[model samples]
Every structure is written in C-alpha cells, then in structure tokens.
Target: MANEQTSRKVAIIGTGVIGNGWITRFLANGFDVVAFDPADGAETRARQSIDHAWESVEQLGLHEDASRDRLTFVSSLEEAVLDADLIQENVPERTELKQNVLAEIDQFAKPTAIIGSSTSGIKPTELQEKMKYPERFVVAHPFNPVYLLPLVEIVGGEETTKEFEQQAYAFYESASMKPMIIENEIEGFVADRLMEALWREALHLVNDGIATTEEVDKAITYGAGLRWAQMGPFMTFHLAGGQEGMRHMLKQFGPALKLPWTKLEAPELTEELQERVIAGCETHAGDRSVAELERQRNEFLVKLIDLVEDYWP
Candidate 1:
C-alpha cells in the first residue's frame, strides 16, 4: 500500500546483510530510505535482499507507504545522509574504519539527526570517539534479518546523552521493534555474552567429540529454544519451580552450579575442526545454498513472528 511520502527518512550507510535488514525494516514501516556503500555491487545486493524480504514483509503486513520504489541508493555518503532524519551506520566492525566513517557521517548529516551504528562488537564509546557531535551518536545494533527480529540493543558512549538514547528508543519502537537500552558500556553488551557462553560450550562439545552439530541444534530447538521463544530463561525457570516459582527452584538447584558440568572457554578452532563443523552443517542443510537458507529462514521468521507476537511481555 504505497502512498504519499513520510518524513521518517533513514540513511543506511552500508548494504551488507545486516544493512539490508535495516533497510527492509525501515521500508516496511513506510520510511523513505537513502542507502550508500563504497563496495562494488552493494546497491544491487541490498535491493535484491529487500525484494526477497519485502515478499515476506508483504505477507505479514505493509505500511501505507511501504514500497520498493521508496529506496534511493545514493553514490556518496554525503548525499545519502544529507536529508535523513536518522543515519544508521552498518560498516565493518573495525574500530579505525568505523571512527573514520562515523566522523564523515557526523560532518555531513544534520546536527539533530541521530547517527546510529550497527556495531555488535565495538562499544559505542569507542565508535563515537572520532565523531564531532558524539552526543548524537548511539549504538543501534540489530540481529541478522533485522526486519524480522524485534530486539535492537541501544548503548550509549561516554559522550552519548540520555536524550539521544531515548530518541533511538522512540524511533525503533515506531518501527515495530523492541529497543533494549543498556546503561553500561561493556563489550558484547548483553545477548552476545549469553549466546557466547552457549556457543563456547557447543564448540567444546564438538571439540571433545561428544556431540555433532546436529545434536547441538536439536538440544536447543527441542528443549530450551521453545521456551525462549515466548519468555526469557529467567521467566521460564521461574515457572519451572512448581508453585513456589524461582525461589524454590533456585534453592533446590543452586548447589549444583558448583559442579564441573560445563565449559565456558571456547575450544581452539583448528582447521580440521572447522572443516568438520562445516561438513556437519552442510549435512544438516542438505543441498541448500547460503542464499536459499537465508530465504527459508526469512520466510519462517515472517510466519513465526506473526504467530508468536501476541505472547510478548
């Protein structure tokens, strides 16, 4: 349902996988998007991703003005962010590259426009270090297939202000996102740390020849992953305590935490291990290419989100 243009113009700095996710989400929300990337074929790849994602986006629902035609792939950073109300940087994770690029975006974008970064590793404090108006810069990290997932982690730098964080919350919320603001500036902010622990254990299991990748995946999908879809681990555990909830369960299970039942450190990723893991994944995936897998995953996400959104807290 394309209609008259809206004022929520978004400037996407890169057209990588994550960048296209943001572009698709913005367009699905009926925002005018202007994207730029120095890499060759960036625009074509981004547009193709949007086209694929828009098929599912349409299946769920479309904003009144959401259209593929609303996307403008500019040739330069200055031109891309010139009239944007919000500038989302999706460049590589290198600190020097991000600082240099953000400094450039800060110079060109409107002073009032929030220059957000999609850094999942680098902290906002490090990212905003070179910006002229650092206070206006905030970390707006999103997961893969950003158009489907509702969680976006917002972190503030040393120079970032609470006002800008609040502005980011408002912007993401308007786009049908769940914006989680992190007060502390720790590396790997929240979700990644939790995932890293689980990932590290999974790697150890494979390294020790205890479990295959398929077994690891089934352990999650058939067990905890189902619970995680509706509520978090804490809430799930709270309900696991019979009538007493978390307090009773913690009292009964807390003592077992001292046992050496798991490993936290990631096993060294040797070449053989890497090959084994890849082959295992290929076996599970059968004959699908990366593009096909992404399409399948995005299609599933569209229906899963529509099916489960009403259960969110």
Candidate 2:
C-alpha cells in the first residue's frame, strides 16, 4: 500500500547498513528517497545492498509504485534534505558526530520536516539540543534489518511537540511499521535496554568458561528465542504460570529474583576472551559467508513474520 500520509519524500543522510535498509523500506512502500553520503563508492554499496535485500522485501510484498529507480543519490546533505518531508540521520554513533550532522540537517531541511535520528542509545534531548527546530526532532531508534522489522521506538525530547510525535507515528505507520511512542526519554530507549541486559549475561557466560559463544546462542535459539518470537518475555512468563497467568507466576517465581542467577555487568573483552568468542562463532558458522547467513536469516524472517502477524495483539 502507498503512504496515505502527506510525506511521500524521505531523505537519508548516511548510506550505511541502517540507511540502506531504510531506503529499501521506503521504496518498498512507494516513497521517493534521496540519499547523501560522502564516502567513495557509497552509492555502489547501497545499490548492492538494496539489490541483495530486494528478494526478501518482494516476498514480504511491495506497493504498486515501489521501485529501486525511485532512489536518488545526491551530492550533499543540503541537496538531499532541501525538499524532503522527513529526514533520517544514520551517521556514525559518536555523540559529537551525530550532534554536528543533525545540526546541519536541521539547518538544511524544511522547517516542517520531521528530523529522526537512528540512535540506539543516545537520548533525544541530547541529540536535539543542537537543532534550531528541536521541536521537530525525535529519536527514531529501529532494530537491525530496518526494512523487515516493524517496531520503531519513537522517543521525544524536552523540545519535541506532541503534534510532531503524532505525525511521526502516522508517517512510520504509513510504511507498515509498528511505531511505539516511548513516553519518557532514556539512554538505549526500551528494546535495546532489554537486549543489553541479556547481552551482559551472555558475555559473562562466555567469559566465565561456563559456555561457548555457540552454546550460549543455542540456549536462546532453541529455547527463549522461540518463545520471545511469539509472545515476548512478559506474556511468555504469564503463560508459564499456567491457568492463573502472571499473578500466579509472581507468587511461584518472584523469590528467585534474589538468587543472583544472572550477571548484569558485562565481562571485560580481554584479548583471550575475544579470540575465544571469535573462534566459537567462526566454528559454528562453518564456512558460510556473512552474506549467505544474512540471506538465510532474511528468508526465515519473511516466513516467520507471516505467521507472527496472525498472533500479534
């Protein structure tokens, strides 16, 4: 379906993994995209990425007007954002770099254009501080494979207006995304914070010699990961309490919270530990290239998403 909202033009400031994913998604949803990246061969790399991901998006379905030809690479940021309805900043994750880039975007983009940052950890307040029109700025954090993942966390800063947030929500929804408006701003937002906690424990498991990287992956891949794919943590646990649901679950397992079964702090990435993790992953990957693994994952996700939609609330 095409976007019903007024935003039909989107500008992407960087052409890295996430930026290219956004381009693919916008094009899939029948939006014209303009991109600007200074690196040599950036255009070539982005085109290749879009080509590679096209098969999966095609499987997911595309709007009648969606086409790779709709994407245009511009020479500068000013040229990219001058006429855009929404500008997505996906530059490097450094705070100073992002702040500087966003300032330039704010200066060049139309005043009514919504400025979104694909920052995973930084709060919207900090990122919007340098923008002249801070009310239009937001932290639009998205997961990896942005085109495939529908959940986008929209966190507002002190300067962000409710009107802009609502417009942002509708804009992403037009692209077939589930835009989650986070009421409070925080580092890492909501989903990343949850993933970071599990990440810390996974690192500890590998560091303590209790499990290899592959083993830890299996623990999730064959276990919690499956359940998480369906109902998520809270609902999964609710079902675990049997007929009574979460109320009974708390009474039965709440005491275990004090058992210290998991570590919250991440282990130091020592040279030896790094090598073990690298070796373990390489061993498990077993000669398949990253591109090949990505292709396999995309195929599985396309099918999984079809099934998951029937179960989503």
Give per-model TM-scores. 0.83, 0.84
Model 2 ranges off by over 4 Å: 265-313
Per-residue error (Å), model 1, residue 154 = 0.0
Worst 10 contiguous positions by lDDT, candidate 2: 274-283
Ten consecutive residues with minimal summed lDDT in candidate 1? 277-286
**Model 1 clashing-pair count:** 0
Q: Would you list the clashing residue pairs of candidate 2?
A: none
Stretches of model 1 off by over 4 angstroms after superposition = 1-7, 265-313
Best by TM-score: 2
Candidate 2 C-alpha lDDT tens digits along 68-178: 999999999999999999999999999999999999999999999999999998989999888899999989988889999999999999999999999899888898899
In model 1, the Cα lDDT at residue 276 comes to: 58
Q: How high a TM-score does candidate 2 get?
A: 0.84
Deviation in Å, model 2, residue 276 alpha carbon: 42
Candidate 2: lDDT of 57? 92
